[model samples]
Target: MKNSKFAWLLSLLLVVALFLAACGGKEEGTKTTTETDKETTPEEEEAAVVDEEQVLNLIMTAEIPTMDSALATDAVGFDLLNNVNEGLYRLNQENVAVPAIAEGEPKVSEDGLVYTFTLRDANWSDGSPVTANDFEFAWKRAMNPDTGSEYGPYMMSGVIKNATEISEGKVEYTELGVKAIDEKTLEVTLEKPIPYFLSLMSFGTFLPQKEEFVTSQGENYAKNSEAVLYNGPFSLTAWDGTGLSWKLVKNDQYWDKDTVKLTEINYDVVKETATRVNLYTNGEKDRTSLDGEYAMQYAADPELLKELETSVFYFKYNQERTGEKTPLANVNIREAISKAFNKQDLVDVVLANGSVPANYLVPKEFSFDENASDFRDVNGDMATFNVEEAQAAWEKGKAELGVTELSIEILGGDTDLSKKMDEYFKSQLETNLPGLTVTLKEVPFNVRLDLDTNQDYEIQVAGWGPDFQDPYTFMNLWLTGGGNNQMSYSNPEYDKLVNSANNELALDPAARWQAMADAEKMLIDQDFGIGPIYQRGLMFLQKPYVKGIVAHPFGGDYSYKWTYIEGKN
Candidate 1:
């Protein structure tokens, strides 16, 4: 099994992906923006709740690192943005795109190149009206290159016209895909029509910002609770940039202020599972992630379990790190490592709860293939380990490369399960691959992601959940130009398949499914750069007191917003 070479095949696949993105006939049917995102007339002068007197409390397992939407890129970043800012559209509980700051679904021009937005007369937490240029400023700033924003591509590059060009220094920043029609309206031109456009807006990276606020505060903006603006239902009450915990209180100035009932939300950022579960049981915290062995006991107590099929826990090989990445350059050696572990057994023994062992490139629950069950035999994978097969591969690989007793380093989290998995991976590789030496290192969860983005480690553990419902979410990671594709795994045919799917857009459902399926198989069949661990299982629990919480597979994710607490204000 060999990895596909995407960097070489990108020219062809990029063209195909472009065609798929523009292939579908005009969609008069994209998700509509939420009420807050709608267009407003001057006569609608009702002042939104901008100065709330009441505060809410929220307890979370993580702490937010940055308040600046452009700079934030992880769970903490998203939590911060979802609470403090608003997008033109929001993902609903059903994971469908709905209006937020826009008046309605974007008005697509007959040519399919232009999109017009009617703005909602919403105000920022600072009492300034949110206008089209607020978005304009944000978009331009995102692509400015000098902003040091890691999330810019996640924002404009794929869907918006000229976005990729501007970000790549191929065009002027002013020429990027968006423009302000007036103070109340915005226009967007996509180089290609994208089915996933509206859904992409729901992400925190696309949240709006006020130009004056941004420039005035400079680096100080989003540095603390008082430095940021609020457009969502709540505002931070007791957080500085340094707090281990914070609070979210109702914002009286919010557009839908009347509907918000939870008066105060207390948040505590607990990274340790034992500490988190203990807080929940000791009544020190209202909500938390249950640790191993505790999940079963808590489940029998009658609380419903909530789960999301996020992709997998994975290790990425950074091929571009000069001295730290040569072994990763050898596909056979990489394949030997992939064949050396049985992650399913690890999950069964270590996870022992909601998390499942993943072996697929894309989560099974995500795709929509009619013949998809028949593509290239899903059961066939190089990752299926036999000690003999592993040894054979390792022996052949080492002989060809002329290496003896190699030293390899792997990084993961400090979790008890992670520690065991690290040990398991080490033992499997050392035993199966003769004369091989392995080293296991554990870091914090957030620190792992940080290292991943920096491509700082040789073999580092990581995972990615879908940003939207499209198969592109998984496939995009392999694209030569993709941000998450840090492994340097490349294949021309695989890239061609992904590009073909994008070109077709929302048309020819059968062909679309097949394209994504073909791409997944090609990548997985190669068995290097990535090892399939398990399809993620969604699992969580809520108090009976909470209601109306949106649990859409693709929605804006309403566990924090749409849920209502009975008898609480």
Candidate 2:
């Protein structure tokens, strides 16, 4: 089964290769041969000499909530930050970590707890040189309790020395283990030897910020394109705090500016599928995503591109609301709802976008062991769909709570496809479990994120894409009092298993892997902390002239550094 799954993935990669190739040479050759048989007009000859426009117009499903690296918690913000900011390292086309701002490799201590890096000469968009102090200031700012950054503590705690203490206000942020030895040198001390530290450096949370620029803005920092500084391949422009449109122009001040191909990239938030498809079909946009029936309709289209992603969607059961335990706090109730929905049908019929039903938190083809074995295959599936079992559990839960009927509201996105999926879930739950009422509350993407952060909903359809390539990224979210644990689910044993995997078992590769696997099973099979839905798959359309857009299974979805325009007139 694993071999076949990998074969499927390889075929998808081949399709991606063809999509990026854009079928350029052969079509141009044939066109030239046909034109040779006839006399070409002077205007036609002149048109042939003109260069194609080096611009890319694209569509986004959601609006970017914030540009602040310390506060971003969604994909849109991360993707935007990824293009406009520079970090110590960046993931290459092959998803391997490579130095970006750092000169080369860091000199590591023999004990593997300290690293000293020599910074390369790079400049921000304003012509000031990027310095080691920028990194130190940014890291300390994020770790400061006053910043209220969820990712800061969640990502750096247990890894960086004194980070946990600084976030908890037990120590000052100045003592957070990062120091600027010189303008071009930075020294960092870690609590332990982290296996994925390089990959983590490429994430948005670790991106640098200029202290003067950020402080000058005061409350306005990163509120708009003009307020933020850029040091990456592109610089954001024409963006207001809450606008639906923005543009990214090539950053001339970037260290490797010569390698950038696209001069401008424009984006507009489009929520409806019909509008997105119309924009693509009318040649107003270079790319658009397909959903539901559109995905099936374009399955054989030459412009269609499909990729199975590493992200997974699930039902987050909020165990507590307003300091009171909710019905979802009961293990039986959570388990009943988890097993009530038909995930296979949800993917095949409702989604129809190459997605697969997911029974576990960690996705397949994502994380691997030291021996190159896929983690999903080793752990297998857990808590799959069973209507009869769901019914039995629901009765028991109702009896325990002394209730004949129960009502709960689920919060989800207001996108056209999202509404359809929400309606289907409501129908399935209400139909399978008698005397149960499911209410749907659909809001815009940004609004939904706010609600999730406030824990204002009873149940929410949430999704997570890995910030880095590791099983721990998915497993760590449910830790006791974790920043991302908005659902209020906690288990001491689960915490012990996850902490040990990253601490005492850090040197033991096999044992660490086992501990993480055990934690995932415990979260799903035993506690029913969250219900797994489906592994995401993307099907989209791209113009033949567009090329070199690199898609990653983790972190920011696509990188446009090497993307370019070609054959189109």
Candidate 3:
């Protein structure tokens, strides 16, 4: 089977710097403004000059949860992880797979099941050699049931030999497919051939972990800047685990440190749009994301840039609540909720960006068939809005639940945009559906993620970005008992289709594509398990001098390795 050419399609993609999660901590105190070249005015535009300190000051909407690749779930963690860690391959400037820690491309078996990779001698930030044994330990740890890595079971299972059994605790971790043949060599055996395997290697979950460092820290691993070792272009600094400010400094010991031009990357979590804009205007920040009316106001600004991201934001319903089945478990109720909300109004009015309303899970232009037809187009929109139909479904669901009135809470982020949208959904759902009350529960990103993982919410607003270039990256999340399936909504037929597409029909391109299409239809149309919202478009305000930062559609969003300050001597 051949890999899809769509792997690098997101190279042209840019997005607003929306952190994938919420942070609860208080915002750091604003940096005191320094004297600027007052001879220039706002009209001059050039007044916002580069800091010239060789530092990239930026704003993050959320604080990073952890640096440990195995446990990090959201884009914020992966964004820092992608820069501070190295895997066998990394996404290049073109968004295509490129060699990183590996000496070169891996050797494949004639059967297409085995991969042998030779490692390049590299050192961790602490000057310790990165050995193939490090990778073997990391892979096994991820697969171990005790590790509790969401990505390990979701991605590796059904792909790597015995990975499913190991994750399910049915087999020893030693039975997992990866092996360290020598200090400089690694061999991996997959259950079957996966065309996007190389791209998957670029994800942080596949990055190596030093056994000695990992065991020594145990629960403290990756808790703060000093807790973990860096084996990539930068090392994190000044992060006290819960603080709102952190820095990424160039790793002088990195194998390719000579090529890293940016010596420091400073980050501060700024939740308010006005604050971010003020910082950028005052030359305290190099970039800031725009939303709501800000996006509309800056629409004509020369510095304004709109990014079409291949990500989907949706509402995932938790079916199994403690003591009783949630109202979401009722198919009619789920369908009603899906239709009651107005997606068009949400994006046009609240977001006010170039984002598109989505009636399905996967975003448009995310993947394509060998014939060049879009996967989303082939699947068609599974959920659509119709007030009359929604009312009818609501009535039917009320009768089924034997209730005259019902109320539920919606869990969401604490960011300004998140709160605004949360209120909108609350109003719409409550107003549109009679005899229903919707409450908003907004928490910091980490808290929301914890609630989601525990399945403690009735309904939650969630988003997903592809980890690799394939429909399966999104499809695999809902597989019967998959790790990312926090909703606990399951359909046997859907599982069958996904399993068959992944394993049995993997080599049959046409059949595999059909199977995925069928599975998605079942998940959305038949089950109504989750409600589709929209595809995000980030409005970016970037300094023209900021150069070489790679905008990726999936896995971490941006890469800082090749990023440099332009017009600098």
Best by lDDT: 2
lDDT of candidate 2 vs native? 0.79
Off by over 4 Å in 3: 1-52
lDDT over C-alpha atoms for residue 262 of model 2? 85
Alpha-carbon deviation at 80 in model 3, angstroms: 0.6
**Which tens-of-lDDT digit does each residue in 1-569 have in candidate 2?**
01001011111011101100000000000111222235546465335434867899999888888888888777787777778888998867665668999999899999978889899999999999999999999988888778877777776777788887886779898898899999999999987665456556776777899999999999999999999999999999999989999999999999998778789999999999989999999999999988888988988777777777777789999998888989999898999999999999999888998889999998887767667889898679999999999999999999999998999899999999999999999999999999999999999988987888888889999877765445666777788886557889999999999877666776677788888899999999999999999887777888767766776555566678877776677
Which whole-number lDDT from 0 to 100 does residue 465 have in model 3? 72
Candidate 2, residue 384: lDDT: 94
| TM-score of candidate 3 versus the correct structure, residues matched by position | 0.90
Q: Please give the clash total of every predicted structure, in order.
A: 62, 0, 3
lDDT of each: 0.62, 0.79, 0.77
For candidate 1, the per-residue lDDT at 60 reads 56
TM-score of each: 0.84, 0.91, 0.90
Instruction: Write out the backbone clash pairs for model 3.
Output: 16-538, 22-445, 23-445
Off by over 4 Å in 2: 1-50
